[model samples]
Target: MKRILRLLYYMRRYWWQALASVFLMAAVGLLDAFRVLLVQPIFDHVLHPGSPSQIISLYKIPGTHYQFTLQQFVPHFIHNVWAVVAFTLVVSTLLKSVCDYAGTYLVNYAGFGMITDLRDDLYEAVLRRSLSFFQKHATGTLLSTLINDIERVQYAMSSVLSEFLQQFFTLIFTIGVVVHFGGKLSWALLIFVPVVIGSIRRIGRDVRQTTRRGQDRLAEIQNILHETITGNRIVKAFNMEFWELLRFRDAAKRLFKANLRSVRAQAISSPLMDSIGAIAIALLLLVGRGQIQRGAMTEGAFFGFIVALFKLYDPVRRFATFYNNFQQALGASSTIFTFMDDQDDLVEKHRAFTLKGFQKSIRIEDVGFAYRDDEGEKNVLHNINLEIRCGEVVALVGPSGAGKSTLVNLIPRFFDVTSGRILIDGHDLRDVSTRSLRDQIGKVTQETILFNDTVRNNIAYGQPDVPIQRVQDAARAALAHDFIMRLPEGYDTLIGEKGFRLSGGERQRLAIARALVKDAPILILDEATSALDTESESLVQAALSNLMAGRTVVVIAHRLSTVRRATRIAVMEQGHITAIGSHEELMQQSPIYQKLYQLQFMDVQELPEPVMMGKSGL
Candidate 1:
């Protein structure tokens, strides 16, 4: 019930439309009751051709306690019975049709409006979540929540609101008319009321539970589809198409069974309600005949009473169905609300200082870090200390899992250090706003992250309105201008997904151009050239050199030749900095550095001579 109320809270913005719809639906119910009452006059007066007293009695105001007749309200000269009945039926039917159309339109207007507002707000909340949140949740499951779950909720809200209003008013009006005519005979309906209510409650509970499980199964199917389609290349390379198909089939089968269970539960309510209603009708008829024969009821009134009683059950049955649908919507709402209420792990401080630009140097002091895992916290880096002055290129080199990438990631505060602090210029990274801190840094990774956009837009991604001439100049410096001009539409051509239309070297060059256009004071290149072929590597390496001209650069590379030109080399091993010096200095003084260098170059082939020798006599 709380979740349902929360869903209704979204309707506050559209209250006027809801109110109008309710009033119109109430009018519709009054018209329906009048239609049933007309049957009494048609049977007793128009069809029977009764005497004047009998006809006048049938025209009495429709209530047990009220005795005034329509003849008292109209002149006898204009009160021809056939003309009055014909005119009343035609006008009432026409008015009811208009009210029905207007009422349905208003309700749907409010429903669709609420859905639009909810979807926009939910999407904005998703965007505000941290990187770690996305790491934990699957893309397909989130998509299912945003698209599928919200769609289900929309159907439920619209259907339930429309039917609930119409049926509630109809039930009230019909019950009033039944009691006015049938009196004691109407009490027979009380027996079936509890039965209907109890059955609806039980069926609704089962449907809600089964529907939640079905939605979960549907999410799993979406996850599989997302994975297989996005990673189709890998699937084909490994020849696992048949395997993926079988997995999809299994997930789909589970979803089918779950939906069947939910459907079976939801479908049971109508027939059960109808059967119970039939029994109540039988009891009413048996008692109604006795009242008619005893002259306690008019034959016209008795037949009208039967019609109103049966019509009352229509709304009752609809209410039961509405309950079933409302339960399904509640299941979907639970998933959506849970995600919206989740707190982000990375929260910025209030009124945090903003960094304008880089100054002297960056200092890493007594840093330690760990990544959370299923077993427990696993340490990734410990007791790391380093100082990088402005305009110096410091190359971080080591074996896999040596924490080179993790150490550099600390500067950007991607994940905060578990122990010590890092300072840029003089301000602690944590003390400054993340947007301001990141604005001063640019990064290019081995896997180039390019959007499916034109060359002009991709190069000027961060600053979309950057001048065309500046974009071209940045591309020229990155050596991408030449190939870009050879394309069909030059800079206006659309690059396919992730720039797959371009070759490896072209894609890396475009990534470099993007960073060059941003022109931040600090840069980090993580294995940027390692994936390309020989020729592509030379082109990309030259572009990297130009990009690193005067920035404080942190280059993490496994290739020995790539880092040879750095101002200094820092050798890391097992989460600690083992040595830091010039490449030649480290080669002679540090055995760990020497072992790595020898393994890569194999006896210093195509390299400079040794500048010094250590006690180890390398």
Candidate 2:
């Protein structure tokens, strides 16, 4: 019931349209019942030509002595009984048809408008979630919720809800007719209604459960499809085509079984409701026949009553289908609401300050972190402390899984530290607004990320209004200007997905240009040139030199030679920073740093002295 109310709340913005549709539906229902009322007049007056123009009581106003007649409905000019009946029939039918059309369109307009707002809010909520939320939820599962689940809801809102309202109003008017004619007999005949309603409700519950299960299986199928399509290169290189096909087939079969169960649940309701309706009609016929023979009821009145009963039952049957569809929508809404209700823990404080510039050191004070804060999860970084001064390049050297990347990730508050805090320019990072903190930091990773956009757009991504000349200057600094000009469209060339149109070195250079364009006070490079060939690495390394110039840089690298000339090198192992010093200072004081250098540079030529950097440093 709460979920139902929530759905109605979404429709509140379109209340005027929905209310108009309801009024139209009510008029259609009354006109339909009025058409049934005409049956009595035709039999009593029109069919019997000698019969007098008697007043036919169509309806009695509730709690009043007043009653409506066919005479009141027909035009004053129409004196003949047959003509009056014919005129009323044509007009009532036409009016009912008009109201039905207008009601359907208006209801659908309200429904579509509500869904547009709902989908937009859901999308914005998903984007606002922290990185951990995305890491926990699969991309395909989120897509299924955003697309397939919402589609089911859309159908229910636009189609099922409109039908339900129309039929509901029709049922009310038809019931009034049945009560007026059948009198006390109507109560006895409708005893079977509760049984039919109970059966429908039970079937609807089963359908909802099975529909949820089917949606889950569908999500699994989507997940496999996304993974196989996006990672096609890896799958082909591994020669696992058959394996992927089998995996997809398994998920498809599971979904098929789930859908079958939902079908079974929905199928049971129709026949059960129909059988009960048939029994009630049979009883009404048996009783109605006696009422007519005893002269207690007129033949025409009994016939009109039978017609009204049929109309009532028609809407009842439609209600069963509507309830089933409503259940399916509710199942989908349950998942959507779960995500919408989730609040990200990384929310900024109400009075959080916006950081404008980096004026002092970034102090990491005994920081400890774990990806998951729940018990039984191991810490990725432990008791880690470091200080990086302005305009200094501090390189973090460690083996794989030594928390090098994780520690740098903390500086940007991608995930908050499990314990302790990081301060930038003497203020806690947590006290700063996330957008402002990220705005002042630039990052370039080993795997370049470039969208399927023009090279110019890619370079000036964040600053969309940046002048073309500034973009060219940044590109030149990153060693990317020469190649960009050689393309068919120069800077306007459309780089395909992930910049696949460019070479590894060219892509890396473009990423550096993006960072150069940002010109952030702080820079983070994680294995920036490690993936490239030697020649490519040299070019990227030179570009990196330009990017790191006069910035507070924190670099993560496995190759020891790259950082031998850094302002300071921090050696990390097993989540702990074991040493922090210059190359010569670390060689004498730290054995871990000494052994790492000896093991990595044993087969390569080592620089004899610390190389001095001019304006730019590598």
Candidate 3:
């Protein structure tokens, strides 16, 4: 009920249009009932062929005050009756047509406005939700809510609101006219109504349930599409395209079945309602004939009663259809409301810390993290501690599953530590504004996530409004300028999907240029050259060395040569930072680091020792 009330409340902003539309519809109903009144006179004068004197009892000339009965004034009698009948029919027809146009225009205006607002509101709600909301919900499920569900709700708005208002008013007005024409016969309608009402409601309930299932199936369809697009390479490599195609087909078939059920429910309401109405009309006719024979009602009155009763049945049939449409909108409303009310994963602190500058060091004090999967088993990172001095290059290296990536991930507060704290300079990471904290660091990952934008835009991505010359200089620093200029459109050339058109080294170089353009005081390189061939790795490494100049750099190292160049190396194992020292020092002290060196560098030129980067005289 609250959901329905909220929907009505929002729709109330367009109430002037809705009210005007309804009033016009009511006028049309009244006019329709008025036409029933004309039937009595039509029967008495024209159908019955009443005496001329009786048909035209009162006649006054336009320019003279002479009046006479139709027995003496037959010409005036015929003219007046024909004129009045034609004029009344024309006026009633015109009023009905005008009323329909007004109602249609106003109702449609409000319906369109309501749906447009809802679409915009839902989109805004999606953007405002935190990362955790995204993690918990599939991207495809959200797409379902945005597209399929929103469209369903909008489709319902037209029939549900307009038909409800118009049909309900028509029903009430038709009832009043039927009672005015013959009261006792009107009461006989009550018997047949309950059965039809109950049956239609049963159908509506089924439709509501099936509509929800249909939306869920649509979500599954969206999920399959999103996954297929994102993991196309994986699908190709594994040769599972056929399996994915079958899965999508199954999801679509389920949706088709669900929608078919909803359609059946919606389709039955009108016919069933109309059949019940027809039975009620038949009952009225049976009782009404006796009243006419006893002279309790005129022939015209009986005819009028049946006419209004049949006309009244249309609105009742329409009301049942409106209920079915309302159910569809109700199903979608739940998803929209859920999106609007979601709790954000990251929130601005009550008293957000003021981030001034990097001073002493970034201290990780006994930081531990665990990412729990669906079954509640956690992948843990345990008791990791490090202090990174400003303007020093620190590298992290160990065997697979060492949690090195996770440790660096915490420093940027991408994921909060499960235990202990990460402090920037001296302020706790949680206390600072996320935007402010992130602004102080630049990250270049192994997967260079370049947008399908031009070279200039990609380089200036961090600072969108940065000058082109500054962007050029950054690209030059990253050694990406030469290749970018060679493209047909030069800096304006579009990078294909995920920088597909560019080489692996070229994409990494572009990413470095983007980071360099930002000129952040701290930089993070997450195995940026790990997947590259030696020539490309050399290029990326050279670019990396230039990038680390005068900045605090954190490297997640896969190569022994890269680890050797770091000022300090941290060895992590089983979620803990087991060792940290210079390459020579770690080789002497850390078995994990020593083993990593032997295994990784054995195929290439061996490294003598780990280097330790320190501040001047620090």
Candidate 4:
């Protein structure tokens, strides 16, 4: 019930449409009941053509001598029984059909509208989540919740919701008819109502539980499929085609079993309700016959009562099916709500001001950071302190797992420090709006993330309307223009996913071009040239020199030539900055730096002299 109420909250914006649909469906239900009442007039007056025309009593007020006549409903001109019956049937049927059509359309409009907004908000919510959220949740599981779960909810809101409303209203009016004619005998049929409802509720509960399991199993299949597709190169290299297929098959089988469980639960409810309905009908027949024999009920009235009772069961049976479907939708909604309900932990401070520009120096005051995993929090950086002023080229050089990348990431506010604070131009990063803070920063990483887009579009990525001249200039600065012009479409060439169509060095050059176009005040180069060949690394370094000119640069360098160009080199050991000085100063002052330089030359005595030249010795 709580889940259902939460689902209805999404419909608040479209309540007018929902309300109008309800009124129309109510009219449809009333007309349906009126059709059953018309049966008696047809048998008692219209079918007996020689009988005199008289007013027909539509309903008798239960406790008084008052009754409602057909004359009160139809025009005065329709006095004859045949005309009245024909008019009522034709007009009522037409009205019922019209109401059903309009009601269905309106309800669907509201349902679809609500779901569309819901899907948009869900997508926005997922996008707004912090980087840590993505780490905790699998890509495939999030995709399933975004798409498949929402689809199930949409089906329930549109088709199932419309049908349920119609059935509910019809059941109400049909019961009214049954009570008017069946009178005391109606209680026998009504007695089974509790049993049918109980059966539906029990079956629906089982269906919901099984459906949730099925959704989880489906997410597993999606995860396996996503992994296989994204990591196809790894799978192929390891000759794991057969292994992957087996894994997929196992997940598929689990999903199949879950679906079968839900199907079995839903399928049994229909027959159970049918049996209960049959028992009620049998009892009604016996009692109804006695009433007719004693002249307490007319033959036409008894037949109409039985017809109305059958009609009542129609909605009741559909109610069971609808309930099961709604429960299935509820199961899916539970997963969606879990994602939507999560508060974004990385929310900006209220009234946070934007960083207008970068000036002075960035101060990392006794910063500490920890990454949380299943084993709890593990410290990544400890008591780290550094300062980089404008136009200063500071490089962080350390062995692997020394927190170089983690520390660099904190500059852009990707993750907040566990203790202390980072100040940009005397303004705390936390007090500044993240968007504006990041906008002033540019980054180039070793991975070189490029989209499946034209060279020009990729270069001018975020600013789609950037002038072509700026794109060409940035490409030239990054030394990517010559290679880009060689492509079949030049700047218009469609680079395949992650720029697969390009060589590793060419892709890296393009990433540099993108950063050059960004032209932010602060630059972070994270192993920017680590993966390139010597020739490519030289060209990228030349490009990095242009990108680094006059900008406050923080680079995580692996190459000796790059480290030598820095204003100061910070040597990290474990999670602490053990030394900060020029290369000569570090060699004289720090043992770790001395040993690291010695190790690089240790194996280089036998190699060709050219290999040792411009090498990253530490």
What TM-score do all the candidates reach, one by one? Answer: 0.89, 0.92, 0.84, 0.92
- Which one wins by TM-score: 2 or 3? 2
Q: Rank the candidates by lDDT, best first.
A: 4, 2, 1, 3
Q: Please estimate how well model 3 matches the true structure, expressed as its whole-model Cα lDDT.
A: 0.81
C-alpha lDDT of residue 60 in model 3: 44
Question: How accurate locally, in lDDT, is each candidate?
Answer: 0.85, 0.88, 0.81, 0.89
After TM-score superposition, the amount by which residue 518's alpha carbon in candidate 3 deviates from its true location, in angstroms, is: 3.2
Q: Evaluated with lDDT, which candidate comes out highest?
A: 4
In candidate 3, how many Å is residue 305 off?
Answer: 3.1
Counting only residues 3 or more apart in sequence or on different chains, how many pairs clash (N, Cα, C under 3 Å) in candidate 1? 0
Which residue pairs in model 2 clash with each other? none
Please report how far candidate 4 places residue 10 from its true position, in Å.
1.9
- Which ten contiguous residues of candidate 2 have the minimum total lDDT? 601-610
Error of 1 at 255 (Å): 1.4
Better of 1 and 2 by lDDT: 2
Model 3 TM-score (2 dp): 0.84
Per-residue C-alpha lDDT of model 4 across residues 359-383, encoded as one tens digit per residue:
8999999999998899999999999
Candidate 2 overall lDDT versus native: 0.88
Candidate 1 weakest lDDT stretch, 10 residues: 53-62
Give me candidate 4's TM-score against the actual structure. Answer: 0.92
Using lDDT as the yardstick, the better of models 2 and 3 is 2
